[model samples]
Target chain A: MQLEIKNLTFAYNKKEGNIVDNFNLKVKKGEVVALVGASGSGKSTVLRLTAGLEIPDSGEISIAGQTVAGDHKFRAAEKREVGMVFQDYALFPHLSVEKNIVFGIDHLSKDKRKSRVKELLKLVNLEGFEKRYPHQLSGGQQQRIALARTLAPGPELLLLDEPFSNLDAELKDKIRRELNEIIKKVGVTTILVSHDREDAEFMQAREILMN
Target chain B: MQLLKTLKKASPGWFLLTAGIIILLLIPNLNIIINLFGEAGENWEHVRDYLLINYFQNSLILVLATGLLTAFLGAGLAWIIAAYNFPGRDFLSWGLILPLAIPPYIGAYVYQGMFSYTGPLQTFLRNNFQLQLSQQYFDFMNIRGAIFIYTIFLFPYVFLMTKAFLSRQSASLLESSRLLGKSDSTIFFKIILPLSRGAVVAGSSLVMMEVLNDYGVVKYFGISTFTTAIFKSWFGMGDLPTSVRLAVMAMLVIFVVLFIEKLLRGGRKYSYSTSNIRPVSRRKLEGGRKIMAQIFTYGVFFFGFLLPTAQLLYWSFLSRGGGLMETLHFAFTSFLTGGGAAVLILTGAVIIATTARMSSNFVSNLLARITILGYSIPGAVIAVGVLLFMLQLDGVLSFLQMGFGIEANVVLSSTLVMLIFAYAVRFMGIAFNSVNSGYEKIGESYFEASRTLGKGVTETFFKIDLPMLKPALMSGFLLVFIEIMKELPLTMILRPFNFDTLATKAFEYASDEMIYRAADLSLVLIFFSTAAIYLITHHRRRKK
Candidate 1:
């Protein structure tokens, strides 16, 4: 399995009951999985837990056979080698498209990092957009840049939280196809949280309906 | 039926609080206006001919010099701590604000005691290094010295404001800059500084207003600024009109500063360009740079807080007869008065903030703006207004007493009531801002939800708003309490005969050239204010 979770229970505070209660999931290598649920149904919480943005109350989360979070041992988000495309795309507003794509690959040599960024930009069909800030991009274009940035890190697993929610219906289908193609081409294991049935259907991923 | 319907439609608590705040805010400024139209006092000619120009020149110089110096020091330190991860950065980040706990007047005395001809620094140099320095080189009792004292103590206002602004910035932007192969210095100059211009300006303006409002540092240093001019005209020359005139001029200068602040921020939005606002992440420095960063941070902490604090500790114990008993008494009394004033201000602030949150009517908005005017006006100016208004009120009470056969004299002004009232007038703005932000964070949706569930406005507020606003209320109270504890000018002008708070006691001893005796009391003030600041900042950090 590329990613595995067992018996996750989590809550922000004691007063509010567990947001994610005994949630369990597993994904095979290079497989894409979708967790579909309405708002406040713990879909995003599960994604965040997988990304190490929030700690689980009782559970084990592993990426590429490494237990990143469980029991007394927990890894920080940056050290977990997990990539997340947030609902808002979370692009660095002050950095251009090319710069953001290379943000997580600083360990690469200069020429190699630049070439990698250029390759990802071409893969996401964002070539020649090296100078534009996030604010200047369309929502669809911004989502593409977010995906490219996450993919540039070469993580074993990717978490997308409401990736299609910010797009219009007309742009959503087109971007959905393009995004799926790029992810499949890269062959990165992916977990996507969505509320739309069409998004799950178009991604051709096995869906888990969260309560 | 109409009256009850109108009452049901509007919260009477809101109207009552707004009206009360408006009256309280207006009385001081109204007194000044009425006094401006009155006849000139005997010394008005002397002040107008000779002293006015000096007052103008001195105040302008102090404000400009202090503003620039504080901005440079504050913004530089804020950037250093905000962006760089060095040894002691965590401690130094908040430790730099400790100077604010020591009042500027007390700082002046401590610096003086450390550098005087017979003081520790010179004596140590002579004994150890066989160095003989001229007295002229060590003399810091002048305009430049006053500016130095004010900047060292007041720069924290800029530092804190700018640090807060920088810390809220998205960390990813900086990380991306680094990933782009830009150096730390390049990222700072190109990205960090430009984004923090608004905070820098806001902090500098606060420093300027504080300089204009100060009476102690200037008075002790013998610099003839507007605040000291007002004091001299009123106390030394016994000229009320001239003092009032000087105060009005000072108020005008404050207004000009505020206007320029507004102009600088004109049409420039400072909100984050994206919704991902991670707290700023500090970049660790290495080797020599790390050592240099540590030295710079500690050096600021030393000169700004530690050196003065060490001097105070030494003096407090070095003095002959122990003033610990007197100091304890003053502490008790200061706490009592400050606590009382904080309670009253918090009550008033909660009502006003809740009302403003409940209603966005023209009247509520205007009342909100009016109440904040007290903070911008100099403390001494507010004291002048409060004194005049209280005297008139006392006169009315005396007339009523004669008609009713009562024999009490100086009804309101003779007690601690007037001083506490003056504190409420001046520091209410502090409480209001905290509580208002609390209200804003809660939003109107909760209130609307409660109303739809068949609760009245009063019920919704007590059950929903109060519980949610506990943190804000507590912080607001603590902030106001600390301000009242450290307050000097208002307490000085309005305290009853023979009344003494810690601030007044310390000031009296220092002015009497018995700074050692003053240290015993000043230390108590610093300890309490520092503890409060520590608690408030710590609580905020934990919440984040």
Candidate 2:
């Protein structure tokens, strides 16, 4: 299993009931899984917990056989080797598309980082637009760039929170197919959260209903 | 062992940086508290028996009166500008904040110079109108005069905060109140006032803090507030212990005020539940009401900023002499010191703010909060604390010298370094708040995204946080720089014997009754501060 979450429980406040209670999930290597739920149904919480963006109140989350978070040992998100695409496509507004993609790969050689950024740009079909800032890109284009940036680090696991929610109806199906192809081509273990049934069906992934 | 492991696993650099800054910030205040428990000086009895009650009475009256008056003027203007459309409303919206550029002490002297018996207003009245008014009628040198001066210059605190609050308030609530047969005045009293109580308390507490912090105004006006008492005991009576005692008393009063303010703003969060947050639209007034609104706002702007500024300009232009180079030299020194201190403070603030952002743990939050305590304490108090701390350090150095044959004398005290350190302590909170707001606006999503992209904390901060926080860093620097330039009490207390900033220079000339000579320096101070105010407000409005 590339990603495993066992008996995970989380709450924002103790007085309020748990948003995610006794949640468990496992994704095989190179597998794509979609967690579908309504708003406030802990769909994003599952992804966040898996990626170590949030610490589960109780239970275990391991990525690629490395225990990322558990009782008495909570690894930081940065050290977990997990990549996330935030719901809003929280791109660095200040950096150009090329700079943002190469941001996570700074430890690599300068020439290698540059070549990887170009490869990711080509993978996302944004080959000619590396100089544009996030604000200058269309919503769908920004989403693609967010995906490419997340994948730049070659994380063992990738999590996407409502990835297609920001797209329009006319472009959603096209972008969804394109994004699915890119993920399959990269062949990384992935968990995607979405409210739309079409998004899960299009991704050709096993669906888990969250409530 | 578990706790130690957790601490070890957490970001040590962030924890240590925040802890170190907090310790440094608190040392001056801690010194005051420690000294308060020590022996009382010989004059302590004299102060307690004769002068203590007077100080208490004067400070109470000044704070209360200024608080009420500023609340009235500030809230009233805020309401008018927020809820109504009238002539100069746009100008008054930001223009009202300009008075903050003129320090209250400078305002005090300018008013005195204009209204004193032999001053311009009285002289003009006697010369042209043949109205030889009595000294009492023209006098603005008493406690009442101090209140007037403080209210006019300090009400912008209430105005800016209340206006910001009222502007963001949901309009539907007011509309519903009106539709339910409530009159405008009735809705204002029964609904608006009740909802805005928190903002009023916040602004009033700020006014009270500034009023208490003031040494120059009360001292120049001959009003014996606690700050003035502290200065007198230290400088006039040469009694450091008594000064510390007075500072502690002042801090006690501030603690009570802050506590009351906290009580007023209880745990109840006041936010609109729905996303339908349509701001209150302005009502266009016609005829008499429009004219009245215009008169009220313009009158405040005129008296608070323009009139005093005009007088300063006139005096400066009239008194052009050989001292022009000397005045420019003081301005340069002021800029250099203010710039240096602002840089140091912003650096410290950025570290603390970033740590507070990166680590959402209790320790970091507490450290950030503790560092801001210096801002609320009076500058004179901080000066006393700084003085005591530096003196002790000097004593330690001399002791080491006696034992080890190393020669070092008062390295930190009696130098520009002491003054800059004092500025950092006094103004670090201002810079921190500005940067914190910037951090708050950007939110944690970007940082979290960076972390999830396999970037470490330090790498993420350098790549993501710093670039995003540039605007905030600039604004914080500018705000602290302007404040350092306008600061009087801290600079006056901590500066080297022969050192003079624009503020101290202006104050010296004004105290010596050379108000004309003071004008050149005052104009330079106001020019920089006013320009900064305009830039800050412009940036804020653009952000909104």
Candidate 3:
């Protein structure tokens, strides 16, 4: 799987380009791509464009050789097969762990979905936490569940935006290493977004300085 | 003596303030309960048997339908505005909340006037298509009609909350969902709605409370809700005890609704670090879909704000030629009266709220919450309670003055003072809420820093707190002032003889089934309200 972004740009108020000048980036198959920059350097915007979460002013985004967005033609986020973990670990607070994991796999057989959730829970070291709500879990545990939930649908690529930022400084290092190890074990193409240089160095197989 | 000394060691000033607030809030409840008890609690049985059930069913139906409609319209529009690049998306973003300026009852009145047999819609059809009036033809004065009108005005709460929620959502979530091969609609149901559910519920609860408290709409439409029944029990049958009991029942229902909503929110806390994320942009609507959405949005706006305002403007002109001067004079006098009352309310609220924030006393904090309890009680119930308490006070005063031959007139019940007092009680909640919201942001460290630099408490308040509080103070003032202008139940009961605010004046015309003149007054109330809302939102935008 290759994620190719070309000439991507975005503006906040339509006139002021928060990120301007054409840009290009690519993440090769089974590689971790880290986007590290200051707040408004268009790093998150690049991720948004690739995920089909946002359309670009004039750019093309191809995921696995399919043009998802370009020339005013766009695909919706659900059709993109790219899993996302938000900065706040935006777990469905209302749903239990099992339900949250199974949420994206509606097209799968019920038994298959259940077994997949079980497998992913074990992979994320949350095998016995299926009945727990998002709020009931510790930040580290929540992040793991968020990762498992994102990967449940077998997305070829996973995009994590500051996934460990909410955890305490004591837990951040441990969680970061754990996150990197799990993604590698699953052999999914991963993009880790962070403002911290250390996090980028630690997590990425290949890194891009987004600013 | 030790306990007494300890009590005295606590700030006497703070104690007095808390006591005053407690007495002010508690007086009405004590009086109402005593009166009900004296009357053998007849009202309790009546409410339990008849009014309780009637109001329960009516309020439930109104709340459920309006909630569903508000959620759909608000979330649907928000999703489009946030996710797609669409023409008119900008226009819809702000224009959608304009209906919030028009109160539900006022909106209902305007719509009823427009759709009634002699209204423009019927008049046009009758004259052009040769249609005649019949009982089977059309009726816009029922439960269904109330739901429609309430939905139009209340949907804005949902719209604003949902829009804010969608805007603040991390863009990466949507992108990841798409990468996983989920369709647009699937993401909306599985992700967007679930994430924003709390906000939607918060907005829906607000709408539900408003529906529960609505009297003018239900009464006019002949839907026998508890609020109307309570009013009738007091004013029509002269059963104050019964009315108080009914009010308590209504409060119980509201408390249950609020509790259920809280339970569903499930103590989940969402935290976002102060960092920039790329915002999702608006999408374009094309062809028939675009036209359909425009019509729907504009149609709601036309009926909700424009139609009512235009009708009122036309009537204002007509009424000017036909004694509109008298109406204008009355309106001005009412504004002055209410404005004076508002100043008093704002002063009391600021003083208490500021003190509560400054003090370390737990009792003072408890007293502050007690003071805001009057907010939960409806205006009519508070008026009744105040009247009874004042009447009792007069009796005691006369008894004490019997030797001097002094006569008593129950001065508190029949003067401008009492009206202002009731206004303060009814609207102090808004003032407290705004002031509290503003105060919470001013860190205690700032206060400590100021104090260590040799600033006194008063000096700190005047120099540091007051300037920071200007926006919230202004907002609180405007809310109380607008609410006073729109108040009907309390004003109708407590206002000195021959006095009328814009709300009561409008209600007079509306009660006569003459909506044209009332439309003018309703529009005036809405204009003032919209200006206040605009100022608050503008201030917020500036701060952002």
Per-residue error for B134 in candidate 3, Å, reads 7.6
Query: Best candidate, DockQ-wise?
Result: 2
Off by over 4 Å in 1: A1-211, B1-10, B179-181, B361-365, B408-410
TM-score for chain B considered on its own, for each of the candidates:
0.95, 0.96, 0.87
DockQ of 3: 0.01
lDDT of each: 0.83, 0.87, 0.74
Worst 10 residues of 1 chain A by lDDT: A71-80
TM-scores for every candidate against the unseen true structure: 0.71, 0.95, 0.66
The weakest ten consecutive residues by lDDT in model 3 chain A span: A12-21
Of the two candidates 2 and 3, the one with more favorable lDDT, higher being better, is 2
User: After TM-score superposition, what is the CA distance of residue B186 in candidate 3 from its true location, in Å?
Assistant: 3.1
Error of 2 at B85 (Å): 2.1
Model 2 residue B217 CA deviation (Å) reads 1.6
Write candidate 2's Cα lDDT for B259-293 as tens digits.
98898779537787787789999889999989988
Question: What lDDT tens digits, residue by residue, belong to model 1 across residues B7-70?
Answer: 3224676668667776886898889978998998888888889888998888888888898898
Model 3: per-residue lDDT, tens digit, A1-211?
Answer: 4888888766544446547448788778888888888888878777766665545667778888888877666665556787887776656544688876776675689899889989999999887898988889988988898788788878867888777678788888899889888988999998878888889887755777866
Among the numbered candidates, top lDDT falls to: 2
Please report how far candidate 3 places residue B536 from its true position, in Å. Answer: 2.3
Candidates by DockQ, descending order: 2, 1, 3
